[model samples]
Target: MSGLSAALLELRRTLDQEMFPLKVGDTASDRHALKELAGQLDDYLLPRLAALDAPLLAVVGGSTGAGKSTLVNSLVGAEVTEAGVLRPTTLAPTLVVHPADAGWFSGTRVLPGLPRSTGGGRAEAGTLRLVTAETVPSGLALLDAPDIDSVVKANRDLAAQLLAAADLWLFCTTAARYADDVPWGFLRRARDRSTALAVILQRVPAEASGPVGRDLRRLLEENGLGPVPLFEIPELRLPENGALLPETAAGPVRRWLEELSADARTRAAVVHRTLAGSIDSLDARVRGLADSVERQRLGARELADLAESAYTAGLTAFDDGMRDGSLLRSEVLARWQDFVGTGDLMRGLESRVGRLRDRVVAAFTGRPLAERELTAAMANGVEALIGAVADGAAERTVDAWLATPAGRALLEDEDVAQAGRLGRASPRLQAGAERAVREWQGFVLDLVRREGASRRGAARAASFGVNGLGLLLMVGVFASTGGLSGLEIGIAGGTGVVGQKLLEAVFGDQAVRRLTGEARSDLAERVRVLLAQDRGRFTVLLSPTLEADPGRLRAVAGTIRAHRGELSGGGAK
Candidate 1:
């Protein structure tokens, strides 16, 4: 069989068996698609089977008076099929199968929905009927059908069935009516599957033969029937020749039949080749759909990537903003200037701030910044802290520093602003930033004070006490030695206790203020610079530490770390 024939046969077989492997709904596209395929298969099979795919069927179809019965008689080499002047002689289908070849028609009932004929008669001759030809040899059959264009529906139906069954369709068209609409219409309908079509252009006129034959060939080619074998049987018109009916094999018609039957193998091969093309066409269409589906999948993947990137890119922007707004500027150096005061800047800053430690102890001595008050303050400070930390950010998102005391204080007090306008920074966020800043500043103050004392060559307290005590002691001695030696009395008279009182009254508060201010400022500046360098934003989150409850800031620092990480995508789900 040709590829097309094989494909159709296989497709029909599968349709007959595989209802639906996936059991998908009837509405599914695949299901609908398969149904369409089945419909196409049903339409294609008949013409294909009738074409020369198998030797069993060679449908002899033609119009009225085309000498169809005569051709059959010629093939049988007998008068078994009635011929001549018997217009519409085949009212009933006729079976002229050779005795041994009759078995192929026994299961005609399996054709499903088609009428069956047991042994037929002449009235039933060309009726819608099927019968195997006795001379079919092996792998061969012939169906002599009624006129397709006849007024009789039975004749048309009979012609249709015969067309459906024939393995080779010998489309017998007389030269006078080859262009008739009805017969060619049937041929076109089955063209997809049918193969090796033989168009017998019979009974042509002598004078008009050339133009007529050329027109027929052109018509056939235009209708996709170009390669169909063509045979010419010029008009006998024996009556016009003043002769009786012609004898067997005595005309061009017989020679055409002989030519067709001469090489059965080549005809079958041609039929199979035609069928193959059909299968290839279907495969190409299916693969085109597959490629289109693949393109859709690629588009989906690209969309997924874009969504993830857009969402994740926020963290990167936030980090860049925080880095820019950080408190590491020169102003930080000024706040911490005293820390580097009298020597190498950073070292001197450390030393001068240390001396301010004692004044720090005295300043907060009587009234400490209460824990409860400081806690509340810290809550506010933490808010201020992170708020300040994130201050000046372009796309600032961090809410509060969460270091309550420092955040609260910083918010109420810091020069800059930031993160939490949400409310206040939580005191918990600082963890330990408050006390850290204070102790840090206190240590520097102590160092500064010690350095100042050393510079003065003695402790200020010791000098004051020594001078006062010595003056009192001298006065007591002078008075007690009222009648003592003249030298001691003269020394007391020259310097006297009054001079010491004048000196003490003149220098007291000023000297202390001047010295303490230097120490305090020195320590404050140093602490500021250190905080900026080591943990500027951090210190902001733990502010007011030097004055009040520093513990709250200690709590908030941890929250800052956790939230920043989670927000940054560093933390796990």
Candidate 2:
């Protein structure tokens, strides 16, 4: 493929992948614009550029009961398509081409997304009916599109798609409804895209034709559509068959189409005009879509940041609880005091360190009742702290997300909304916290065993057993008075002193300090992992938006803009 084709293809791929799932910044309109742009790429721009020599498709579209089908029939001089009193006369789009030009419309050359049908019966929804007519000009095909203002949403959507695919639009509107907003909307879009177009003012009395035509022409000029060809089909009775309008009524349009089609230069000029305009219009439309994608990306990042902040706060709270000696309370305090004989032994411990070492070593050899209780109490305290922090982070994230429209939409998603899962900690968080605490305890025990492996007190460590030493280390971590102030220091200070002295009895004062720092760091890392797992619940909801790369979209648009000459040259070929 050429560079321009490759760039356009990349643009299509980017648009296809962009979800705009987050309900951020006019998302509904952005999504609609995205769909329209993609549809035009598939149904018109790409295909037309690829086969510029193919017959021009002039889609006849307008408001409901505007006589679009009748115009197509009259122009072709045959009832190749159905026309009736039904609100939406055309259930499916019908394409009429000369027998020689049938090959162009028979396959997937244009409007490739819609299914093709050749059967005589009414075409089903989303199916295009192909009819061969000798009356149609050789280089032109007339497509009778469904009503642009049909009550059926599918019909209206199909109408817009068909019109976008046309090299020329023969927009038909009755004189009475010429000023309606719906038809003007399509006309304005045609003007913006520079699509070759003609307007037919149907059902106009001869006397009223001058005034109505002038008014419609003025409105067209006001909307930047002054250059469009305007045709007035004066009110006239239908033939006995009622299948087509009188020849005089459609003669001017018929003659114009034949003249345009018979002259290859005129036909190619129209094709090139619409093709060039469509390609040129892509720059702005694609850029707008890129902006929407960027919004989705940024909105998702904001939500992820909220989740990160909440969990970071959770980790900080966990650290505070660990350092302030908050975990060494009630049962844990009683057990520690009992295990170390705190009241008297904790006194004057700075000067009595050598004498108390023997008592600490002997106390660990037996694994007393107080030691087991203290171990259990310490594990329970760590687990509780983890669970509380995890829950707080989850609640905080949900509360923050609810304040934003896009975030609230994600939280409302069925997957995230089951029993308010996103609003609180995961049900399995308690178990996960418990598992993390157990793993940290094991890690501390390993650290103690490794630290004691090459020390003079190795025998004392073995006698105390790795488990007993590990218990004292855990106490040292929770009993740290580094973050305490006022009463907290006094309450947790004694506990810290007792733990320090006990560990020093087996592994000198320096080893005790190193061991405590290592164990505390290990526990904090484990808690971080646990909190991260909980945070995943919110971030996962944003995965679709986060995964879309906005830079790629902008790059594609830039590529197209830089290589416009290449695309124009290719289309001209």
Against the true structure, what is each candidate's TM-score? 0.37, 0.91
lDDT of 1 by residue, 311-347 (tens): 2233233223222322222332222222212223333
In terms of lDDT, the poorest run of 10 residues in model 2 is 345-354
lDDT of 2 at 549: 80
Cα deviation of 329, candidate 2, in Å: 3.4
Worst 10 residues of 1 by lDDT: 471-480
Predicted model with the maximum TM-score: 2
Regions of model 2 farther than 4 Å from truth: 239-242, 330-361, 368-377, 414-419, 480-495, 567-573
Q: What tens digits encode model 2's per-residue C-alpha lDDT throughout 497-567?
A: 65677678778998888888888898899889889998987887788898888678778889987877864
Report every candidate's CA lDDT.
0.43, 0.83
